[model samples]
Target: MKKAAPVKESGLGMMPANSNSWNIETHEQFLLSELLPLVIGYAKGNRHPSSAAALASFITLSTVLQSEGFTRNSLIASIDASRMDIHNAPEVLQ
Candidate 1:
């Protein structure tokens, strides 16, 4: 039976350095530290809207509101109401 080709490890191919110059361990480190932020920002925001920016924005806003000691549910509701107000049609247009 023929053996299958070796599968590359996660983050291996994404490393910015030349694979031959850097050892696999160092490559993995760069992938985690340098590359991940770029990947997350680019890929998540562009490709996966819900899992990426929208979700992140909601979490960040929620955290900030909580730190200010606001009631969480009330703050969320207020934000939603404000969004609806901004998005709602002008009365003259009705």
Candidate 2:
């Protein structure tokens, strides 16, 4: 059997140095397409399908929740920025 190539790095990064920068990269495809199969094939030593499926589901759900939280925070920050703009508007423009 041919050995499959190792998966590429996910390019995960720490927070941006610039406070105003938001450069998030997502890897749902990598998780579903690559990691999921690997886990199902080799997880728990016995490679039980039920065990693998359960673990994969948990991981996928956790990742999705984290992503949702990030999106929610971004929206809140945007709203705050809009409020600042309103407060800073010239009296004539108000």
Say which candidate scores most in lDDT.
1
Model 2 scores a C-alpha lDDT of 0.53
Please give each candidate's TM-score: 0.34, 0.27
**Span of 10 residues, lowest total lDDT, candidate 1:** 4-13
lDDT, candidate 2, 1-94, per-residue tens: 6743322333233333564233222555676788767777666567576676776666665555455454556445544655776557444223
**Model 1, 8-94: lDDT tens per residue?**
443433447564553435577787787666657765667865456556656765765575466867766666655665447344221
Cα distance off (Å), candidate 2, residue 17: 11
Clashing pairs in 2: none
**Clashing residue pairs found in predicted model 1:** none
Candidate 2 TM-score, C-alpha based = 0.27
Model 1 score (lDDT): 0.56
